[model samples]
Structures are given as structure tokens and as C-alpha cells.
Target: MTVDIENLIDGESKFVSFSEKISLPDAYSVNGDVLVKLSGKISNEKKGLFHFSGNIVAVLNLNCDLCLKPFNFKLDFPVNELFSRSIHKKDDCLSFSGNIINLEPVILDNILVNMPMKAVCSNNCKGLCEICGHNLNESDCRCEKEHINPKFEKLKALFEESENE
Candidate 1:
């Protein structure tokens, strides 16, 4: 959703609340769509700068990286930003013009940053077996495994000889 920033241009501090429901496009490769709620206030600071701060809440459905199972997760983050007349960096500060503020990129970037790198369906997931690629968490497989490296067998024999001695 496109947010209009013209109202914030006025020389008055106002409370503006907006809620947006967006679906992750196919490009994102997300398992399911998510609902995002954003509400905040915009105020004009000294000079032609504006400040937008608020809270963003969202729920996402993603697949566990380990188990490949789907799970729902919640995200709650606070939004804080400073705008100035021109984009400049002095010491440690951000500035933007008061006439126009594009919030789409900011919102999207924040949400993406908060996403978990490794999502899990449960705390303990057995995951898949290496032998036959079977989902061990679902069921047990009886496939006989073979060890190709003969050096490993020699090491096992050494351990067995030591135990016997």
C-alpha cells in the first residue's frame, strides 16, 4: 500500500495511524501470506525535517529450515526514523525532505530484517536421515548403511584392539 506523506508537510504535529494487509509476492518464495499492521504518528521537527515513529505487528507463516515443516511466527518491532530536507550524513544522523516521504521501502526493509534466519517448526526436530533422505521425525527407516572410507574402519579396529588389551 502506498502511503501519502503530504499531510505531514504541514507545520503541525499530528497522529496518523495506518494499517496495511499485504501478501508476500511469489518473488519472495514465502510459504504463506502474512498480515502486517502499522500505526504511527508524524510530526514536523525543526527545519524541513519530519519524524515517524510507531509500532509494527505482523504474523508470518514460514517453513522450518531444518524440518521443512510450516510454522507461524509473530513479529513486533518499533519504528523510529528522522527526516531532513536533503539526504546527508553528519556525524551520525539521517535527513529527508518534509514534502515527500516514501515509506514503502522503509517498511518492507524493516520487516525483512526482522525475519528469522532459521525458522523451526518445533524446538526439537529430528530432521531427515542422511542414508535415504527419510524424514526421521515422521518415521524410522531400516535401510542398511555402508561406510565407504576404509581408513575409518582401520581407526575402529585400533579402538577395538585397545579395548581388548
Candidate 2:
């Protein structure tokens, strides 16, 4: 995604919009191409400084962390950044050389930063059963419900004795 600033005059702002599917090969968790929609304004602040302020709407295909099921995740966030023609050693603004400013890097950075640490299909999702590796969301597992570690055997005997008395 690139925005043309050749016609933008100093102190003038132009509205920019883009709707496209972008491939995110760096995003390991993303299952497919991301649908990105960007709407924002790019303003020429000075001779070489420009400011871009806008909103992004993206749809990502991801797998649920719990059940490993595929799902669509929607992300909406605001972006405000600076672009400069000259590079500064300690500057945070992105540097651009030509009249066109590439927004792909900015969009990718924002999407990655805003991504959730854990992706869950739903709050009530039932994960796979540990013993049989069955999908608990689809059906119940026949594995024993109560399981105690060997280290807790003494504790279990104590509880049994107390119950008998």
C-alpha cells in the first residue's frame, strides 16, 4: 500500500484510502492473507515532514489457541505516525525518499502490535482431551474423569480413612 504525495502542497492535507488483501508471511500465527482497509489523512506539516492519521480495519484468519480451530479475527485501531524525507539518527518517524510513501510496513507493524496474545474461538470453548486427544467441544471423552498423580496416593488414602470414620 502506497500513498502519493506529489500533488500535496505544504500545509495541505489529503484524504487517503485503501482496501486490499495483503500477505503477512512474517506473521506465523496467521493462516491466510489479511484483508486490510485503511482510511486516513496525510498532511504536509512542513518541507519534509508529513503526518498520517487514520484508522485501520483488518480481518485475519487465525487458529484458536485452545481448540486449534480456524476463525476470523477482526481488528480495528487508530494510527498516527510521522514521515520524513531526511533521516535522523534518533528520530522515531519513518523515513521516505520519493513522493510516494509506502504504508505497508506501517500497517504491518500496527497489526502485529495490536494482535492478541491468545486467540480464543469463544469463552466456553472445550479444548481437546489430554488422554485421548479428542475434541471435547464436539463430544464427551470416555476417559476416566478422576485422575490422581502417584505422588498424591498417600493423601488419597488419608482422605479415604477419614471418610470411613
Lowest lDDT sum, 10 consecutive residues, model 1, at: 89-98
lDDT of 2 by residue, 1-165 (tens): 898999899999999999998888646346557779999999999968999999999988778888888878889999999999875622878999889999999998998899989998888989888888888999998897667687788898999999999
Candidate 2, run of 10 with poorest lDDT: 25-34
Give candidate 2's error at residue 119 in angstroms.
0.9
lDDT tens readout by residue for model 1, 1-165: 443466654566766565666766553336445677888877777566677788878777777777677767788999886666654644333544445566656667678888778787677887777788887789988876575588988998999999999
Clashing pairs in 2: none
Off by over 4 Å in 1: 1-11, 23-33, 87-100, 143-165
Instruction: Report the lDDT of model 1 for residue 48.
Output: 60
TM-score of 1: 0.66
Alpha carbon deviation, residue 136, candidate 2 (Å) = 1.3
Q: For residue 7, what is the lDDT in candidate 2?
A: 89
